[model samples]
Each structure stands twice: as structure tokens, then as C-alpha cells.
Target: MRRGYWLILVATILLVTGYHLRFQAPATITAEQGTANLGNWDFTHQGPVSLSGDWLFFPGQLHTPASFLQTLQTTGGAGRAPQTLPVPATWNKLYRHQSSHPLAQGRGYGTYALKLTGTGHSSLGLVQQPACTSSRSYFFPASAPSSQPVSTLGHVAATAPQSLPHQQPVFSALRTRPGAPHYLLVQVANFDHRLGGLCRAVYLGTQQQLFDLQLQRLIGQGLTIAIIFSMTIYAFAIYFYTPHNRSSLWLGLWALCATLYFWTRANFWEQAFGTGGTFGFAFHYTVEYCSLLLMGPFIIYFHHHAYRTRYVAERLLRGNFAAVLLLCLAVLVTPVEWFTRYYTPLMWLMLAQLLLAGYILLRALHDRQKNAVRLGISALPLFFTIPVDLFANLNGKPSGSYTELAMVFFVFMQGLVQGRRLGLVIVRSQHLSDSLAEEVKHQTASLEEKNYELLIARTALEEANRDLKALSITDGLTGAYNRLYFDRQFLIEWQRARRERCPLSLVLVDIDHFKALNDNHGHLAGDQGLKAIVSHLHAIFRRASDVVCRYGGEEFVVLLPNTSPDQAAAAAEELRALVASTPLHYHDQEIYYTVSIGVGGLPAPGPSQQPLDLLSAADRALYQVKRDGRNGVGVADVIAADIRA
Candidate 1:
């Protein structure tokens, strides 16, 4: 009845209020280049709302990062004439950049306006398309490949008259063939961000459904492969991250020995593995390989950093980065075979690093915080979540059992554990408070008669109240804060950040296809998986200031204080990969589960400034991660992007 209860009630009310506010308003976005004219588009964000209309997109020209950046930099800000560019064609060969190595100018820059009110045919084509060499397409980030060749003409003209009831902002398109038949149909309220382009779909007669099905199939395939990759990685992670945390270079290397997945993801991968190659090879050589190499040391350092083993970890990181960078540069100019030779040590280095991380954690348990011990104890059950069928999957064993009863059981258990974690926190808190009160009452000289008894009662009540206050938001299953707690905490943090003019970050963790796991395994195994995760996360995240909480259902949230989006992303990625690498098993089934994370952060200066925007941004980023294929992290900032509409 004192200020305590009032404060708690007020806090709870405020949080609930904020939850609804989140869905109240849309984030304003600014118009940019192609987006400057779109009429039928939606504003679902707070930053730049470029031309994401019912229009056509002159997909990017293929250029090296340098040239691409130059174009962006030159035309990015305001008050600049649009560059003269061949709509969808690259300047790679035209500019004689074949020998430019990693610095080739292959990007497209420019915008064209158009309008589509009815289902009419209109052709927006390109001139002088790049030659489609199978090798070239494999390694590069291709926005759109030329489906067919276009004829180049001296000039092109817009024959259709622009007519509409209102002067509406339309959309942009790429280079059009001087003469070609093109038609587009724009539908109202059917705005989609699926690759956000004007003339997003080709109206090929009544066969539109076929294209849609094909597109969906392609996406489905990518997703299928990604899920497999994630599962494999997750299984390996848990297996590698045993309670011992000792070096397992041999095992880790064995797991990662295949380049098939990596190659499949990159354009250059096809160059090396594909029948004919080297067209899309430059980007892979310079950027992609270097990126992997850079990650090697970090992986090693994280795994082995805790080890008493000193110089090897640091040296590995430095050397790996340097080696990869050099290799990347050489890849730009050198052939695949020559590059592969230098890349050999990279494999050894990666294996070494993974081993180091394992050892460091184990040793840290032995000589240091021993938190590793707690994590191990807590994580043992997760070791059981490994699907029984995992061995066959790894060994390329002909999926001996499609219907894995053991795997199903484990997933079921994980769900139960997750549910219990969510539901029992309050019951546990109450129990703890009651027990504490009883103990204190008995210990205290209650009823020194009446006066003493009254004081004792007051004390018991006070202690119980405090305990309940703590229990309200904490998750019973994983000791992390519950969604209720996380939301309240986020609001409070947002208020603080606003008042103090500081940064706040949110990491949203989603166990990949957890629903499938639940469907396969029983509820109990799912619960166990959740519990293991809560325990493991607690150990990895030792910072007292950080907040690890359960955010509704299977999603977990981590809030970092005074951290940027990138930092939050790095932290999330590390945790994700670590979770993936940790070997969790159950019964005969041994399969892995991965996570897709989204990070969002912003500067908040007051309570009046809502926390919903940040949550929305983070959610958008998370959505992007999932859409792009789960098992990764995406940090999106509408503000940094100057998004407005």
C-alpha cells in the first residue's frame, strides 16, 4: 500500500501503454532518387523512403566497390545533376576496367521516371548489356542479370504521354532498349518491398502465376539450403562446445572442411567450382575471402581468448587477417588455383582458432571464473537436443531416417522447457518470497511481544514485496528477464537514453525453425532447448549492465547499454555462431539449430520520445535477416540512411 506497490503498478501500466503505442503510428521515410516519384507505396519506417513504388527498377550495374562508391558519393547528397548512365548496364568493359582488379567500376547510377495506371504493355530495356559468362555471375552480387540482349540505338524517347488525375510521384527504371515493347500493370494497395522495384513483375501473358511460383520455388530452395546450413552449423557448434571447452582442432576442422556451402553463397564460388569461371570472381577474391579470413582470428580469439594460452591466439588473428587481405588483393588479379594455394593456411588457421576458443573456455573454467562450469552444467541438457540423425547428415549418410522420433522428442521437450520458463517465474518468485519471509520471521524476535511482533510482520511484508518486485519481470525458466520485464526495461532505458542523450541497442534472437523442431520433437525437448539457451546466454553475457530477457514465445532479447548497432550486431553474431557451434544432443537424434538475429539502436534523449521506433527498426532489421535467409544478423537504421517519405 506504500510507494513501492504504487511504483510497481505505475511501471507496469506504463509498459503496457507503450506496447500499444508501438503499433499506433507509422515511421516517416524520405524520398530518394528512384523512390522520389513513386505514387503507390507505403511508409513503414522512419528514414529514407526511396522509390519503392509500383514501378520498374533499373537494377544496379556491375562494378567494383570503388567505382560503385564513387557513384553513390557523387550523387548521394542533394543538388547534383543525375549522372548519364546506361540504365541497367555496367561500365566495366566500356570503361576498359578489365585490368582494374578489385577497384573496377561496375555499379549503376541514375534514375528514370514512369507511370502505369492500367495493365498495359510498356518496355523499359537496356542497351549494351554485359556478356553473361557463367563464371562472372557466380562471385558477384548481381542485382539483376540481363535475361535477354538489348539493341543499342543513338537515342531513346518516351512515346506514351504521362497522364493522371493528380501530379503523383511515380517510380524509376533502368536503361531501355531504343525500341522494344514493354508494358506494366500497377495494382493499388499491392505495394511490395520484395526487391522494391518499379515494373517489379513481367506481365508475360497469363503465365504470371508461373513466374510467381518459380520465384517462390527459388526462394524456397534457398531457404531449404539455408536451413540445412544453419542446422548443420548449429549441431557442430554445440558438439564442438562441449562441457570441456578444450581444443578440438581435429573435429572442428573435419566439420568445416567443405567449401561447398560457402562457394554456393558467393559468385566467385561458382567461378572456382563452376564449369567455366572468373567473371564474378573479383569480388569474392577481394572482399568475400578477406571477410572470412578476418572472421577466422575473431572466432579463434573468442573461443581461445580465455585460455592461458597467449600469443598463438593473438598471432593467429593478426596473421589470418593479413593473409586474407593479401589473398583478397591477389585474387583480384591472380587465378583461382594460385589463390587457393595461399588459402590453404587459412583452413589450418581457422581450425586452430576454433580449437583455441574451446580450450580457452575450458581453462577459464579450470583457473578462472568457473562460470564455464555453471554454463556446462546448465548446457548439458542442450547437448541432448542434438538430433539422432545428425551423424548421417554430416557424413553424407543417406538420410537413414526421415521420421526421427528422437529428434521430435527433443524438440517437444525444448518447447515445454521454454513454456515453463515463461510461466513459472512468478510462481517461483512468490515461493521464494514466502520462504524468505518465513525464515526471517522465525529468525527475528517476533512478538518481543506485540510491539516486536508488529515490527517483525512489517519486515516480512517488506521483504516479500521486494521479492515480488524482482520476480515480476524475471523469467523462471532461464533466469533471464521475461518479455514483460524486457518491455518495461526497454521503456525505462529509452527514457534514460532520451534524457541522457545516449545510445541503446536491442538484439532479437530467434531459434531457426523452432516451430518445426516443436513439430518434430515433443514439447518437453523444446523446453530443454530454451532452458539451455537461457543458461548458456547468461554465461556468455557476463556484463551486469546488459539485459538478457525472453521476448515472447521462442524469441529472446538482449539489450546492450551504450552500444551502437554494429557493436550490438557483432555481439549478437558471436553469440549466434557460438550457439551454432555448441553441440547440443538428445537421444539418438543429433541435429543443429541456428538463430537469425536483428539489431537496432538509436539515440533517445526522454520519456516523451517513444521506444517503439527502436523496436520497429530492430524488427525491420530482423525481418531483413529472415528474408535474406536466417542464421545471420542485420542491423538497419532508417535514420542513418536518411530515410524519409
Candidate 2:
């Protein structure tokens, strides 16, 4: 088929899809007035109710929910997906006129308002009421979070009021009998971006329900991840599989490093699958950039097209790599909200990346070379579509399927080009029989030598990897187990202690006014000071079981698997005095840095015990010591007693 025909075919499909989405009917439900009244309703078990009919009216500003979705899906998409919204976040955000979470592509943005009115319980609280846990059909008995029971509406159940703010402000002073229609008024509208949005409301007078929602903001995140993965694969292919060898081997190796860093070292897997939180959120957000950084060398290698290309591309590549690394470090070493403002800096970085890709593609197009043009064309859709896709999702007009279709086209085109080129080369190879045989022999011998060397390297790598993994747990400066290692060891030790019913002590060591020392001298001198103190801590960490690491830039954590608070304090005090006595000379000032230590011991460690809580208790004690005076140790329980007194 002609390529033009393919384009026309795809265009027809899109038009048909859009036409289908543009018009759709609203599902109707019978109602008495513009209201509904019922008691003890459960949406979770019953799912979305179709309350669409004559009395079931929406304000003129907004269309019915079912009809609205129908129009959107038919015009812009198919029932394949309805753009997801972030659920369980602050409702206060929903009211903003232009407020939008990340949606499909960068091109989309706006806000929509939704309101529901019924003459019934407006008392559903903001706190997540548990969905029905019982397997009963349609309904269950009413109950409260407390041990007490509550009223029931038909088979539907309502829970007693707890210390939760009412989620809905609408008032309802009415009731309904079986088959009798009631009134319901729902008003919804969007202020910007074509007034495009979703306004869904449910009145499940009765039925079983399950909750399903798209975390809209999460779509931007998922798209970013998918792009990183796709781009990485492309880079890997360019470096390892492409006929161009100007710098292929090195580029491939760097791509491998980036892949490892993204998957393992950077904690992308942890955030997506493991524990989700500030750490998860932060990692999840930045891992894409880290992956990009890792993929940079190959981008540069391929961007230059050959070693013969200008020095500036190579220089720019290094500069970009360094900037990314600095950004990563800055994020880690600095306080939150400084560099992570979500919009400004992040948007700028995304813009920079777009420009870079644009320049490469434009340059490739101008070259008039087949391979260069092919490479550029292969990556064109991704470069244009991914960011646009993110912007749209954030704006509530997502097109994930369109993006996937573009990607499929790219892969197919690239594969065809590569296969054609390889086939031609194979047909031309018969003329150089002697040369080909010699080349094969040389390659075979080289492969054998490489295999032997690889075997030796593999053994050495395994042993080194094992040791490095152990050392990774240890804080480099402190020569003790670091936070990452401490976390792993803490779980193991805590479980053992729980099983054995034993005590565990944790101490937090904060250097009093260490920041002042750095201010006085310099960061380099301060680093040396920390190294000296870590050396001391290392000497004291005698038992194989005890673990310690730099908990904060200026703080250290010590874990005693089985020790009392008193014992922990004694250890802390000894380290403090040793640091005080061991003064170091930095710059003109012969600086002395003292340590303020807080010690805490668990009466018993168990699954329920949080290691951070123990650290927090120690931190509170350390605060008390700092208040009393610097250069001292305080135990959490002891300090608590003194504070009480």
C-alpha cells in the first residue's frame, strides 16, 4: 500500500472515532422533582446509578453525566477510556475555575464544577467510610466506625457520625418508598479549555457497588514513565544495533548504566510498587529525568552522527549530564519546596528537552541523508506527542490510544528500513569470499578471548558486588551502616527482638552547631570534620550486630540491637567527649565541633514498632539536651520526665 493511503486510512479512522464520540444520548431515570430522597445509601456497593429522566435535571450550564461522557467518548475517543480524575484529594481544589491536574497532553487545561442536591443524608463525611465488606447483594445493615450501630434505609446501610466533617453540604429533608420517584438536582460546568470535563453523580437508592476511578494526575506520571522506557529502548537499539559504530559500544554501555540507575539505585520500582509517600512521590517524579540523564551519552553519541561531528555537541552532552546530576544532588541535599515547586522549574526542563529533540530532528531532516532522515522520522512522533500528551492529560483531554498508535507506526517503519538495508548488504557479500572468511576467523578468535576474559571478570565482579552491597549499607563517612542499610537491618533485628521478646535501643547523634563550623570555614573543612568523627564512630562500632550511619547531613544514627536506654546514653556521651577532645584545625580557626546526642530504647520491639518513631524520640531528647546546653547527651524517657517536672 502507498504510504499516502496509510495516512488517509488512519485519518478516516480518527474521523469516524471522533464522530462517534461527538454525539451520544444521556441515560434517563424517573424522578418527582429536581431532587432525590433516600436514607443509608451506599455508592460503593451499588456502583453508579442511572438517575436520568424528566425530573432528574442538570442546570442548563452542564449536560447530564452520562450524556457528557457519551459525547466526549464518541467525539474524542471510544468507550475504551474515560479520562480519570484524582480521587480522595482535597475537594477544595475542585472549586477553582482554572485549576487542573495533569491530564492527556500539555495542550489541555481547565476546571469544571459539579454539584448534587437531594432531600436525604447530606452527612456523608470527608473521611473514607468503609465500603461494604460483606458479600450481601444490594444492601447490608447500618453501622458506625465505633462499636455502635446506626439506622438502615431498605437494605442500604449508613454509619454513625464520627469526628469527620460532612463531605456534602446539600440538605435533604425527605424520604422515598419503593418505586416512588423523588427529586434530584445536579449542576455542573467547566470554565476554561472548551468547558470540557466530567460531572458524575450517583443516587443508588439501593444495590451493590464497587469503586473504580482514574487518578487523573497519575496519567501524566504513567505517560512519562512509558516515554522513558521507550526512549531508553530506542537509545539502546541505536547504540547496539545500528550500523553506525562511531561510538556505539560506549553509548550502549552508558545506556545500560542509566537503565540500572533508574530501575535499582534511584528507587523507581520502590515508589511504583513498594511503599508510596514523600520518598515515593519525589522518586517517582524525578526518576524520569534520571533515566534521561543516563540515556544522554547515547543521545549525544548519535546526535553527533559521528566522531567527525563538531565538538560542541559532545560538550553540550556533558554539560547536560552534569546539570542533571547537580539537580539530583540539589534535590537530595536541600530542603523540600525549594527546587521541587512542581510547575516552574519542571516545566522549564521539559521545554528544554523538547527544544533539544526539535533541533536534532530538524538537523537530521536538513541533511538529506537516508539513514539520518530515517532516524529523525523514527523518533518524530515521540518527540512531538509525549509532551503534548502529558499537557492534554493535565488539561483533562487525554489521548493515550492515539499516542500508542503513533508509536506502533514508528516501530514498523524503523523495522522495515533496517530489514531492507540489511538484506541489501547480505546480497552484496558474496563477492568478497576470502576477505569474509578471514574476517569470520578473526571475529571467532576475538570472541573466544572475550569469553575467557568475561569469565574471570564475572567472578571478580560477583565478589566485589557482594562486598559493595554490604558497604552500601554502611555510611561512607561514618564507616557504619547507613540509613538504607539501617532500614534493612532494623526490620530484621526488630522481627528477631519481637520473636524473642527482647529490648532494642536507638540513638540519634546530632552535631551541635556544625552548620556554624561550615559557615566559619567552608564545606570542604566541614566534610573533613565529619570524616574525622566518623572515624571515631567506626572504632566504637565493635559488635557485629551494632549499626550506625549518617542519618542527616549533620546527624548520625546508632542502633544497638539489645541495649538499655542508659547503655545507649553512655555510648552517646562517650562519642560526644571523644569529638570534643579531638579538635581539628581548619582554616585560621582551630574549630571544635561538639555532638548533642539523644538516646531511646524500646521496652520491646515488635512489628508495630516504627524505627523512625524511635529515632524521633531520640531526636526529641537531643532537642532537650540542646536546650539544656550543647555538648551533652539526653535519653528520651529521662528527658520526658524532666520536661514533665
Clashes of each: 106, 38
Model 1: CA > 4 A from native = 1-465, 603-609, 638-645
- The Cα error of candidate 2 at residue 480, in Å, is 65
Per-residue lDDT tens digits for candidate 2, residues 526-611, read 88887777777756656777876778688888788888777777888788888898888776667777888888887666555566
lDDT of 2 at 330: 69
Best prediction by TM-score: 2
Worst lDDT window (10 residues) for model 2? 131-140
Location of the lowest summed lDDT over 10 successive residues in candidate 1: 188-197
Candidate 1 residues 1-645, lDDT tens each? Answer: 245534754553354334333322122223333222223332112211211222222233323323433554576575564433222222333344465532123222222222222212222211111111110111111233243222211111111121011101112233322223222212111011011112111211112332333344334334333433433354345434342433223223322322232333323243334422223333444444454445445444434532344534456557765765675576667644345434445545555554555555556666654234533343233233223233332221212212222222222222233233333554665576667565545434324667766755575556455656756776655556888888877878777776676778888888888888788887776877787677666666668888989997788888888887777888888888887887557776765888888888764433434677778878888889999989898887744421233
